[model samples]
Target chain A: MQKSTQAGFWKKNQRALAPWFFMAPGIIMFLVYVIYPIFQSIGISFYEWDGLGPKTYVGLQNYRDLLDDDSFYTSLKNNVIWLVLYLLAIPAGLAVALFLNQTVAGIRLYKSLFFFPFVISQVVVGLIFTWFYAPGFGILPHVINFFTGTPTAILADDKYATYGVIAAGLWPQTAYCMILYLTGLNNISPDQVEAARMDNAKGWSMLWHIIIPQLRPATFIALVVTVIGALRSFDLISVMTVGGPFGSTRVLSYFMYEQSLSEYGTAMGYGAAIAVVLFAIMLVFISLFIVRMLSQERNA
Target chain B: MRSLKALAGLALGVSLFATAAVAGEIVLNSDQSDPAPKKAMEELIADFQKANPGITVKWNNFDHEGYKSAIRNFLTADAPDVAAWYAGNRMAPFVKAGLFEDVSDVWKDNGLDDALKSASASMTIDGKKWGVPYTYYQWGIYYNKDVYKKAGVTEPKNWAEFVANCEKFKAAGVDCLTTGDKGGWPAAGIFDYINMRTNGYEFHMDLTAGKVKWTDPKVKATFAEWAKVVPYMSANATAIDWQDAAALMAQGKAANYVMGNFAVDTFKKGGMTNDNLGFMIFPEITAGIPRAEEAPTDTFHIPSGAKNKADARKFLAFVASADAQTKMNATLGQLPVNNKATAADDPFIKTGFTELSSAYALAQFFDRDAPADMAKAGMDGFQEFITHPENIDAILERLDKVAAKVYK
Candidate 1:
């Protein structure tokens, strides 16, 4: 009788339980890795802890310390610079995609060639740029020396180091955006473009009024990736300047790693505070992106 | 059906066997990923197993940089029976946290007190030894004879002559001092030598220990002396690695590099022969000060939570022996901390051994001596001072601010 009743319950709920059973792995992962850590990080930000030792609750001390910290302010400023400069990838990617849109003899080869930087790793790009700007021996410095008679090591100078790292980041980031735009370009309707051309719309007007609207989804994804990329600008800085020329090139993400996980860094609580601030900044743009994505989904 | 039952039986047997732990095995974690150090470790383990046949060692070797952070994690989680670390303030965090076992008994029983006396001060905190120091290497001014000849200057005997030679090197369009602070420890070596020369080792220790203010007049005096040499340092040094700076000296583009004995490898790899590569003690600044040299030590410790403390202590004692140290240092190309142990026959190691032994006192290098946070801030200040010597007051003030918080 109990087995028959249990079987009846299973038969009744099978349809409702099936979707949840399928989603259990993803739901468990999200809770464990993403949701729990965010709260744990926030909890840790109130304490003073070295990773090896006992943690002491200091009650907002880490954030209070950040207010007076020049390095903190420097990182915040550099992150702003990264966010602003990194967006240039979108327009630059659009330009490259527009140029590559034509049917040429060996167009597939040219498309893959343009996509080369994206296929390679960010570390390789950083290393290539490091060699290019290396003073006394690097090719770029040699060329600059030929023109100006004074060789400048851009990564060595605090004033220009962030921009130099940003330039390296932009190389691969632009290539990625170009690939997205090229795919979006492929799905553009020939009939609409033909109609726009018939209406005397060409070049800039054609792009502004007709073609760009078709590429909206690609532009949205590019913006999302670029914004997140700017927020998490760590690897290039780590490989290139290491947040140096005395910490001038530091952005928030690199600053957090330097404070917590680096060889000399043991201020775990302070690092968490930096992480919270970065998360808060990211939340603003993330919410905006989400709202746009949701509204677009509804519209579609 | 019969085949399926056999497969299930096999899987269960494999699982049961895999779950069983070895009875007399001890695990050791160390960062000796380089060829020489890894081979030395392997030899040490083989020799140890041959001597003590009842026990076995399971070693986990990590890359150098990764091990620094990994130690903190593994010490808290699955503690190793033995761990490789550094002496001095580098080990202080583990010691204070009670993660490291008090191996003072091992030291006493093994007579490491008199044998490893050169490193005993660095190994001790709260009047108890936390680990056994196996090896150390000295730091000093390494220069290029070719560059010196080109600049028309001989090796300086004292601070005045060193400063005067900087002028000549400047006139000859060569950097008198080449150091890369990208890793942020090389510049600290320069600061250590200058501070030890200017105010003495005691004052420098007090300063790093946070008893003295960074803006103290004595500290300012150290900076004043540093300011005299800053103009002759390599341009854009912050962008370069220590290896790059060694390349500068090897290429004869720079005259003097304040570095550790280990950098001799990089210099040799850069096509510099021992004939043209010279090692000298940093010149005397305050003439009456007793010479103090930097010789950072490598150590091994048993963790407090280690399951096999008996075998770990035995391993520590074995590592402390003169024979073991001699063999290990021969492979490492470094000076063994055990007084009776012989260093490698390499010229750089010989000079390091002589200098370390003869000094009035030995210090761990600045980064190892100072607390990590302070070491980083101090190195950054020194690097900035190298570039903008005029910003001395501001840099010192910033260091004082950090010291105020860190020591508190």
Candidate 2:
């Protein structure tokens, strides 16, 4: 009777144990590299350090100082601008996906070609845009001159530098969103589409009511990625401007780097504080996303 | 339960034993981007290893931008045994924090007293030496003699003559000066020279250290004078790199490039010779203001927590020796920091050495003298003044805020 009870327990628990064994490696790596570092960085934010020697506890002073820093305000404003403008890529990508969703000869090849920019490195994209925006000899300047009889170097002009960089960032981001939507479009139910058509629910009405709801998972992922991408906009800025022309194009990431690491960046504590604030801003979005996802899961 | 506990204890003992038995390795970090300098370092490492067979040396090289960010992170964590670093106020904070090993004994043993006294002065904090000098290149005006001749101009001797030469070059359809302010410090160098010439070396040092305010009339006048020469600058100068700007002068498109002696190679690569290029000290601005020369030096420092501190000190001493400095500079086209080191065959190096020796006092490059925060503010002010030459007062005011926050 004891042997039979043991056999029954093994049969019941094997599947649960097997899944945990499969998940162990990934969970362990995530805990070590990501989760621990977040806590460690937050701990470091309260101390004044130059990345060496004893760290003095500065408490809330670093945060207080940030409030009065003009550069902080500029960076925050630019981040907001980056986020708002970066979202435009979502609808723009959807439009492109829908245009190419129909079956056509060599459509797979065409889709890949459209998706190429997202595959290249952001550093390379920055270089390409820098050349494109350079004055006199660049294609952009010539195009502007042909149309307006005057050419303005986009990057050198402080008013336009951040916008120019954002536009370059969108090139890849839009392609990424397009690929997501195309995959979503591939999985849409044709039977539902036909039934909606029979009921005279067509075009915009059908899309809004049927197509978009079905693509909700893909849309959610696209928004999440776009938001994160906009917030972490550092590579392109570093390559194109290095936060120059009077730091007009400075973002929070570059500003943090400037404070922590650059030739003049010795305030490791101040840099950590800035990073904490950035992380806090990101946390708000993450929490909202988690709540929304949980509700959706519950409803489903 | 007894078997499980025994197994866990065994595993813990093995891990602790492994940690204790970890072997030591010497790691040297450097930020020199040029292939030649890296190659020279590799050769030096091979030689050092041969001399000490039991010791192992590992070289880690980083590109310019990557190095700037990574060094700080590395220093905070497991820093390398030895690393190349900038001097001046750039190293002052690090020295003050005691992140670097005090190498005063090594300095004395190597007898680098007179040769490196100036550089040592920059590296020292509270009378403790932190690093050994490696290579320091002089900053001056590198003009294309062909461009000057084409424009019917001669190299300037003083402030008035420099302005006259600029007028002539502009009239001849040549841009009088070309610079890349993409990083912003190149323009700051010009600002430093102007301040040094106008107010003298002591005042310039005082202003950068925040002992004086940015809105001082002398500082204001320096900006005013710099603005007067803006029209003679190359169009689209802000977008170019220093190398590309040198290329412009090499091609006779621009009349002058105010840069370091390291630019000699860039010109040679462009097929320009010593005859085509000429070097001069920054044109004097006033009759009696003792000229403050801008000389950026590169040195090596041993981290306080380095595992191979003795090896690092040995390497530093070797690099500072006249023989090593001569060989490295001759190959890399940089001026040796050791004054006693034999001069190279290169004309640019010889001229730079002569100019440095004759200067009343040498100031480390402006950005290096000022704290990082202040340097950023000062560079931004210079960029703003360059773009809107009319808003001098506003620029100074913004810089004053930056100075106040940083200096206090």
Candidate 3:
């Protein structure tokens, strides 16, 4: 009788636990690579070492040093600018999605061409912009000369270097967001749209009251990606300016790399400190997102 | 089914045996990416393997930037049996941590006493030698003779002449100098030159070693003089690299480049010859100010836990040998660190060697002379001063604080 009881229990629970067993590999990988290093980096922030010899404990010293670092302030300010400007991608993406959602002839080809920038690597985007901003013979410089009678090198000037790089970054990011919105639009219910039309609602009002609510998931994903991309903007800065023109275009990620790993930089402890600070700043947004997601789950 | 199972088991057994047999190879880490260096090292390894008969050498080569981060992680874990590294304060911290093998006996046996006298000074920490000198290159002003002639100016011999030439070049509608500040170290070279020329070599060494302050009058004067020449630099220099700056000189768009001798290859690739390019030692600031030349050296080190220490030491001795240095530098276009090595057929290298030997004193370039942390602060100070020359005092003050923190 006991054996029969155990068999019945196993039969019921095995199916339920199968999904989790299948998830184990992914969960372990995520925990090992993504979750653990973050905590380790934060812990290392409170010490000083040159990646060799003994580590010295220096509580709050690195943070205190940040208070007077002009580059840090410039980076923080540029990060804020990047975050604000990056949000334009969402609305711009939605507009493009709406335009491309029709089943016209060769519409697939149009969508693919529009999505080409997103498919290309960020390194290529940086190179393209670098050529675009090249001083004497590049297209943008020639255009500027045509308009203002004086050619301007966007990357060489400190005033425009950050914004110039951000514009280049935004080109591909906007396309990605557009493709996501297009997918979301394709899944919208035709019955709901017909009912909204029957209620004399159309155009902007219909989009606001009915169709827009359904795009919440798409918007959430877009916002999350944009924020993360803005925070982790190292590659574009590295390839385009290398935190140059007097360190005017330095973001935290690039600054950390410059401090820790460059030929002239071996301050691993200070770099880790910067990384920890950036991670902490990113955590606040992540926590808010998690809380919202959890509340939505509970409501469902 | 039984036949298939037997075949699978046999294959698995063979694979496992092959893996086990191949696990004893020694890995070597290097940062050289040029095909010539890679081929040269591979040939050397093949020769070593032939000599040893029982060991294998595996090469792990990384590009310049990739190797910087890779070395840090590799040293902490399973480091390679041999690696390439920079000399000076860069190697001191590693030596202090006992991460490098003491190759004193090997140095003594190889008759490297005269071959590596300069490198020995840079490699020694607390009276222990830790590395073998490989190849080093000289850094100085590389000017386009055509541009200088067009500007009606000659290569400057002193500070006054250099400034006058800069004014002449600017007046003649040419950029007097071109350097990339993207990495911030190129500008730091100018700062090092000014400091070394303003004060003596020992004083410049003291400044980098934390024995002196950043806000010292001598340091301040270096920036002051640098401000006078800032406007004459190429307008779009910040967006370029050292290679691009060399291209400008090759194209006859820029008057001069203050860079290292490694730029010889870039110039040659750009179709510029030795006749089109001229070399000059950085001029003196005053009659008594001891001028120090910037010579960046590359060296090889054997890690402490190497499995084949004898073979690694043999490789080191071979690298420092006169024949090896001559062959390597012939292809590398770099000045051999060994004084006895004959100059190659390359005219650029021959000229560079003559100017290097004629210099009053040879100081390992600024980035190597200073600790890495201090170098960053100093370079950042240089970039700030270059961009906003009026804020020199504020920049120096900030650097002074950073120097205090790092040096302490």
Candidate 4:
């Protein structure tokens, strides 16, 4: 009789709790892996540690040091450059998607080929670009040599190193945006596009006034990921230049890795401070993203 | 039925845990994931197991770069009984933090205080032994004999002669020194030898240990000497790696490379031989400073948190023995740290052995001797100095800023 009563209780409450039950695993994972680490890093930002040694509570000394660190400014500047330049990929991707949207023969093959760079691992892409930018024998230098009558070592020049790495990052990143735009284009309400076409809307105006409004969801996601991606640019810099030519290419992520996790004795507090700054910068974009998401939810 | 199955699984997990706890195994983490070193480690462990007859050895291997990052977490959290690390200032932080066990007793019990005396000073901190060094290799100038002969230049002995020889090599269509500073440390070997030669070994040690300032006039003098040689260094040095520079030497595009003894293999692979390849100590920059060589040693340590301290100490003692070191370094193509071990009759090995044995003191290479952050900052300055020697003041100032922060 007790078992029957318990089963009866479960059946009655199941519908009300079902959604939460389904979301429990994902919520738990996000909380543990993402949310917890952010708080832990923030807490560590106040402590002076060498990763292995006992941590000393320094209370904002790390942030004070960061204010004086020239490398920190350089990384901040580079991150801004990455953000502004990385957004170029979205429009470039949209252009490529529009160009290839035609149903010509072998169009599928062309689309797959266009998506090739995104399919490759970022590390492999970095290696490929490093070789391409190699000073003496690389194709990039040869072309530059032909144009200017002098070869330029792009990655070795501090002024050019970050841009070189950013170009490599942009190659795969642009391909990624292209795929997203392609999917968004496929999902566009054809009848609305046809009606716009009938009304003589085409080209840039058509893209602005008609098609893009329909692709807002895709655009929002692209902006979020691209902003996040630009800030976390570590792997390519590590692979291509290792922030070298006198630390010209270091971002906050790579700088933090160098400080806390590298073979150099760990400056855990300093690295955590850097992480906090990076997180705060990211939080601005995330907030804007959340507000936009909330407004969309209200409209729905 | 379901509850019984769950109970069975729990019972099995408990039994397995009990067995593991009862095993009394000593775990070792190694960075010798390369085939030859891995095999040598296996043989050494086998021999050790045969001798002990009781303690089981569980060895885990990680790749070199990954091992560097993984070591900190393991040392603090899940430390193995024994772990491999580099000697000299590279091991200082771990020792300072009390992460490494004091193994002076192992040195005393095994007579390693005498047997491994050459490496003992580096392994010691605060006058206590912290780790046992197993292998080290010498760094020197590896030159192309063909290029030198074609230029009609003999081995240079002093600053003036070295420059004149550079001119000769340049006239012969070969650059004087082929170094790749892309990784930043190839130029650092040049810096280490130059600083040691100019300011003496004591100043070099003091500089790296952060006792001396980067803006010291002596440090400037070292850069001044390096600046004199800048005209002869490869123009493309900032773009190529060490291997690429070695290829330049092999092809006679460049005359020499200043690197560790390990480059001998690359030289051989690049089709240069003992006949064409010759080794020379970096020429004296100052008349009176005794030549202190760069010979970074590879070592093993007992993590303070180890579960099996006895077995770990036993392994350290065994590693310090001439027999074990000889077998291991023979496979590793490196020099044994034990003074009593006999070296293989290889030309490069013989040269390194003679040079290191006769040295007044051994300073590990720049990256190994200095703390990691300082080394990174210093090497970057060195690379920039090579490109823009006129900006020496700025570079040294930048280095001072980093050294002040890091060495503190």
lDDT of each: 0.91, 0.84, 0.81, 0.88
Candidate 3 chain B: minimum summed lDDT over ten consecutive residues — where? B15-24
Model 4, residue A285: distance off in Å is 0.8
**Candidate 4 stretches greater than 4 Å from native:** A1-18, A200-205, B1-24
Error of 2 at A2 (Å): 16
DockQ for the candidates, in order: 0.72, 0.52, 0.55, 0.60
User: TM-score of predicted model 1?
Assistant: 0.96
Cα deviation of A108 in candidate 1 (Å)? 1.1
- A222-251, model 1: which lDDT tens digit per residue? 999999999998999999988888888989
Relative to the true structure, candidate 4 has a C-alpha RMSD (angstroms) of 4.3
Clashing pairs in 1: none
lDDT (Cα, tens digit) per residue for candidate 1, span B220-321:
999899888888889889999889989988988899999888888899999998999999999999999999999889999998978789889999999999
- Per-model TM-score of chain B: 0.94, 0.92, 0.90, 0.93
Across residues A1-300, which tens digit of lDDT does each residue of candidate 4 receive?
999999999899999989999999999999999999999999999998887668989898999989988889988899989999999889888889888888999999999999999999899999999889887668998999999997888887888888999999999888888889999999999899899999999888888999899998888888888888898889898888877877778888988988888766488889999999999998998899999899999999
DockQ of 3: 0.55
Clash number for every model? 0, 1, 0, 1
Off by over 4 Å in 2: A1-36, A195-214, B1-27, B43-58, B62-64, B68-70, B73-81, B307-312
* Alpha carbon lDDT at A213, candidate 3: 94
lDDT of 4 by residue, B1-408 (tens): 699789987876665455342355788998998787898899899988988888889999999889998998788757789999998888888898899999999999989989998888888889999989989999999999998888899988887898888888888888998898888899999999989999999999999999989999999999988988899998757768788888888988889899998889888899999999999988888898888999999889999978789888888888888988888888878898899998777888888999999999999789888988899888889888888889899888888888888867
Candidate 2 residue pairs that clash: A264-B372
